[model samples]
Target chain A: MIARNDRLSGFRARLTGAGLVVLVSASALLSTPGSLEGAQAAQEAPDGMALYEAGCASCHGSDGRGAAADRIAFDDPLPDLTDCSFASREPDADWIIVSKAGGPVRGFSDVMPAFAEAFDDDQLQAIMDHIRTFCTDRAWPRGELNLPRPLFTEKAYPEDEWVWTASANAEGPGAIVNELLYEKRFGSRNQVEIALPFGFAEDSSTPASSDGGPASDWGVGLGDIEIGYKRALLHNLRTIFSFGTEVKLPTGDSERGIGSAEFQIEPFLALGQILPGDAFVHLQAGGGLLARGHRESHGTAEHDEDVREAFFHAVLGRTFTSGEFGRSWSPMVEVLASTHLADGAQPQWDLVPQMQVTLNTRQHVMLNVGVRVPLTDADVRSTQFLVYFLWDWFDGGLFDGW
Target chain B: MAGRWGRGPFLPCALGVVAVGIVAAGAAESGAVTGRIVVAEGQVRFAGEPPAGAEIDMSADAYCRDRHDETLMDRPVRVGADGGLADVLVRIVNAPAASASSPAPEAEALLDQEDCLYTPRAVAVRAGQPLVIRNSDATLHNVRVVPDSNPGFNLGQPIQGIQSTRSFETPEIGIQVRCDIHGWMTASIHVLEHEFFDVTGEDGAFTLPTLPPGDYEIEAWHPTLGTVSERVSVAAGETPSLTLEFSSG
Candidate 1:
């Protein structure tokens, strides 16, 4: 660059390179920004780059790239502002608030000091605008548009995460169901995922035998492994749409009664929408084509062909952060509907009410707990308790940010 | 690159056709017609010794690195061996105010992203004039423009050879343009209210469009260096030549 005189003559340059280093890592941009700062960001933006050099550059570096680990006081990994895929999407308010109130306001490392003493709202806003310039690419969807994940409804945003989910019957026979899901993002709008299901169940028909060393009535085994691919079809500031397909392999033993030994292919479409007041809606609709399975009754085996099922899931929720920028808690309710593709087949409905909370400072790891209560055929279907541990591996290692 | 002419979307193959339609419709850009009313011609030169070249680290992107055999340098301040300053904005700031017949450049200003760099890193255009930003690289790139006066837009161009056309309604100087995917790729779009400006090329030479003879205020702007201004008096008999100098050290 030309040896520009330090006369404070440029707008974006003075405000951006002027020195207010927000050090707002890619994390602030990776997640949705509906918290206190984003919600209250003033529309008018004044110059703010001046404060970053004094308040944040010590650790964030003068260029918005994180300072060297050895140079900073803390050992935490700093956010790279140059990463466009993760840093471009957050609104100016999220970073402004983080800069003013410190990292803790948004569940970030406390090492990031607050700059409220140095600059006002417009100044902070100017710095945020400058900070955003670090990430030039606008193709990646902004993290602020990525709404909270639902228990059953698939979200539209592509992600790099791992989720372990477990469920048990709240009533009747004791059954434990578990699933491990891994999702990987490849390009700007494509993602691939795989899910492994396993479970254990107790047979109420047989009584426990005191003479036996192990209970013969209980069954435990792996179920079906599902592989799927999804591509984001469209996305704006508030809406996202995706189309995907999944194939399930019959890998479990049907006689154990713990797995479905039938191969199936499923196709689905998912959508996520951000509403006012931190509210969100997620919808997933799909169909399943199942292959014939063998069933034994009275020592005779029967096989049926051409089985198909259709399903629809909708989740409605709102996110609330603890005091402006603390841990985020999202309360959501899901409505699920399914039906067999057969004559006179009746549709089954269920309601899943759940809450999702950020568990660490980085806010990459999260937990969601809820119960799926069968709305139809209550006598046969049992209410199940559901819980999941979600890790956004793309953000950091499982134990890195905590 | 499918949107190779500038409406956006790194969309699926199906959407490629829609992008092509948009490009075809907006393909015709009306270029300005210049008249033979030249007032002055000059060269922009460095006032001091040229600075050493700073290499740009293209290792982050293999495609960019593979495209070049040698290293890339960030040449924000380009000074030729003869002392000519490249990429400087030179214009008559007071021509339009004086009611001189100044017209915009007949050709639309085009910014292309090739070899993971913005071709012609610095360009000058008039207000209401169309600026076309194109992606010539095979890899992914998103062009982000956050002008202080105009509405900001961040557009994705995943496909190769795609281009987008946009214009700034208001006049603003030092408008920053960048590629988010490649942080090193940057450009500046200088939008002036009047069409009496031009960016100096390798020789750092710029000639103002025909202007009526009068005392006109002239200004020179460098992206890295600060802005400089000079007063010039034009006579009907002669086309005056002057040197615009930028500070160094």
Candidate 2:
């Protein structure tokens, strides 16, 4: 045992000494005067095509398809620049940072060497311009068009996403509500969505039994299940418009007060406009119609007249980035107005203030939190706290980016 | 070990010198080509007869009606008196890879809309070159560009003299530009990567200059009439002149 322990200790010492030598040699090679001069001379050249061919074409092939696996020294797979589906979505600024500062700056592989000393900011931008030519197809919208998502207003751009939302009453009966939404994009402009809601709520109402005794208890049950289809009618760099329809099925227990026991159909039109200075406005207008009459707890039709409600929601927000191509923060305010279509119905107003933040280096996962405050009919309606976490599944796996 | 380090620094410098020398030589050997395009057998004709109702129905917007004295109909084909075709895009389809490295021209291509009509009808621009859109009409006109291989943009110009600038990152053959308000107004833009392109003038003449001596596939495209291509070769110090003829069936 003693002999084995001494051997292990000696092996560890030798490994440490070798590691130190390697580190010192790498530092010396990087700090050499010849390297510094070469970098300076590279900055003086204004031709981006020549620079890319000399520096990047070795690893990322001359056609930008990446070197073959057999030729690459690293195990990490290289990105394919010719695929517009992936290349068109990354902003030029992000590519420039990855090139000049190395991949680890964006939580990528360190095998990508830093060219900060070799290329100035302008030269780096020019190199990115040359890289942009790899993707010839431009039907795919640029990443700059992917604005920050608002809390209340749905975006017009179709997406493949999954979102989990939770809300709780802040000023009324103790209750917790959660919703899971899954959306899948089909064609260039169409998407299908499914949402399931379930919650636990305090039974605020009491029922009188036949024996003349009051019975009430907290309840946990499922809410209404909704299926929706949305289609983008027109889109451009500055604006996008879409129309969608949703059908809600009565799936919860009406006696437990977990959901509305009536079937409802809603159709809405949404519009997104890009404003100057990274600001944007989203507008949604829709009307809901009760497919069936309202039902009582005992499963009896109670209302003779149909219920129809119309609502208008608008959200205004602006995005600010942490760095040139880092996480983004958006602050938004939503104004909601709703009124019954029947006679003698008055409009009700509400306000929501929210903040959304990118939670991952790829900016594919995000979180939003907000407070919804009733403007009118305060006594009847209560304030609620809402939060949601969104995952853009098409970009990567949920656990891929950190 | 000393010899290896010394040679490493010298290798890159030697390569850089050779590359610069090659580029200078290629630039010096460049030549020019000139061409003229003419319509062979088709007569310029208008589309369907005028609508029975008030022509164009500009009454939807009072401003548009006031701007025009008579009815307006779109003219799809325009053939000059000398059998020359206007709005024909003549270009070298296959150019040398080195030619793509040439710097884009600094001037911006102009597309103007006056009296609720797009002027010039068609325009061609190089990729990475700016395109300036001007609205000279009195009423509101929203310019919407729809391209198959480029990012699309829509802008509203309510007043006169409104100018907007846009550029495409990639090459696309033709992009359609239209005014949503006046659905009848339309224009097309061709985006190319190289400088060997020109739109035929009133007399059906085009010139592609500073081309290296090589075999090239020259093509002439018309919006209504399809495309025609032919192969041509040029030798050093030779000024080649060619004629492209288009026929409407």
Candidate 3:
């Protein structure tokens, strides 16, 4: 009987020990936050209340009661932090460390990010200084830590001017073209330009058109309105996106002039890099999709409506600011090129070069004169020249008296 | 001549061995420090009338919130000054090897947010034991922990009236906890691997349980009052009581 009892007892002891091991293993797995027992150490220390308000209130709400239950659609009710039984039993330092770092310890979201970078030791100490106010049973002695205000620098706007410009180009509807242009500055970085060009064709054999003209049997004058917007994307980068419509205003013959209004949208991104000695260089490139409805005989030519040609454009310019005649001015040379891919069999290209002189600081003005030359042998002999004037509306006073 | 030579070296060697033995024994005696941590007063004090809340954070940030470098925030205790439970955390910092655990510790650190306040304002645990943080209130709590001298972690226990458990793997200096909803509620946590520590009860009495026989550097960490440390010694299977005074000194 003794021998049999001993065997049974040994078996029972083994089973019990195994059961205990399983329970402990399970419990440890549920409790451990990995190899770093930092949470445990934090549980040992305590933090202050004021510091908690400054850092944790932005997201966790001001009271320990929790955020508005309706806002986040929480699945459960949040507990209030004032319970004495709960408060008195908590470890001292655990919450302090968690507050400084963030709320990942308790499986909460990282909305309350770590403030180690923003707050220094002294500043963090001051925030902690505020936390001591929450302790009813304890007293907090204020320490020595002071904060100073920062300084700000003011900026003055530059002066501007109005400029008149004229240009001639040989790539449109007529042999010669005249354009009157005006531009104005509304603010430090914004400007508006308007131009009206009239073309008179000698032979009326050109394919393209400018603005305002009569209708001819062989070649006719077409008009175009161009609106543009210039926005600074960065310190040295500016983009210009423009959209315009081509309207064949009635003059004499309706058959040769542009039939209806054709729409066009162009977005250009450019970068200007300032070089040494008050000099700068700018480069811009962009693509535009043009659509035009073909006209037959004073009626809707729907069948002729097709995706015209893709147009590619590029502009390069260099600016010079110092001289004897101008102050705070830049005289720049500009070159622009465009290629059309509408008729797949043969493509037509236009090359333009212009010179511009800009003066004034706040009332800035730019005067430009250029010519457009076609490089294709398609018997399209047309040219144009344009002059424009620009003025600043928001000029003078503190804006320009830098 | 043979007898004289043999006796000369043997006598001196024996004496030298005896002296070394005595020194080792004395060294062991000086390395043992044991003591107890208890509430200094009868119970936690209340400045005004205790509110009609479910739980209260008696510590600086309620629940005796603990933090090494972060802010101190508190939760309102539900029980007025008349409540019975006061959470307190006791810790051991920078102790001698003889006072710490061997390889890993066998104790546990419990962080419970009951009645919106941290139960046991402060606590201490072995280096390898699990630290359990549970939300026992009826409300929702997203426990945010800010730690010092350690990597911080945050967790949200969305369950209503359910317990949420979390553990720390590394031993950090100290940490603090807060509810996203209730900013008034706050608590503290500390991680260590020593055997000598205690948390003051509501009646101001703390007992260091199951401490091995050795000398330890024990500290009483309070959120508002700061920390107090003392050297103590303990014998095998003996319980000792320690008193801490948080005065102007």
Best by lDDT: 2
Error of 3 at A40 (Å): 46
Evaluate model 1: give its TM-score. 0.51
Candidates arranged by DockQ, highest first: 3, 1, 2
Better of 2 and 3 by TM-score: 2
User: Interface RMSDs of all predictions?
Assistant: 14.7, 22.8, 10.9
The TM-score values for the models, in the order shown, are 0.51, 0.50, 0.34
True contacts kept of 1: 0.00
- lDDT string for model 2 (A1-402, tens) is 101101111000001122223322332322324231343344334477666764576567778999765443346788898877677655566778777766655656555655565567887777777776776654454455566776566676677899887777775555677778899977556789987877777676656667987554677878777788888765544566677888778886566546665577878777766678889877776667777866442224457456666666678899999977678899999876666565665666678899999998867899999987878777756677888899988877887757
Give the per-residue lDDT of model 3 (tens digit) for A1-402. 101111111000001122223322322322323211332233223343444554544344565555564433224444344432223222222234334454332223354434444344554555443333233322111110000000000001111233333333345433333333344434333445443433433444434445556544343454344444444322311111222222222222223332123444444443333334544444443333335543222123433454332222333344443442223333344333333333332433444455554334322233445544444432543333443344433233323322
- What's chain A's TM-score in each predicted model? 0.77, 0.76, 0.39
Residue-wise C-alpha lDDT for candidate 1, range B1-249, written one tens digit per residue:
211111222112221111110001111213211111111113222333333346666665567779776766665655443334566677777765743334554577898888887777788877777788777887656566768998766555544776777788788888888764466677888988776777766455565666667787777777787676677776675455554444433
Worst 10 residues of 1 chain A by lDDT: A2-11
> Positional deviation of B119 in candidate 2, in angstroms?
62
lDDT of 1 by residue, A41-135 (tens): 43213344544543455556668898765443346688888787667545555777777766655556554545554456766766676666566
Ranking by TM-score: 1, 2, 3
What lDDT does candidate 3 reach at residue B79?
A: 15
Q: What is candidate 2's CA lDDT for residue B175?
A: 87
Best by DockQ: 3
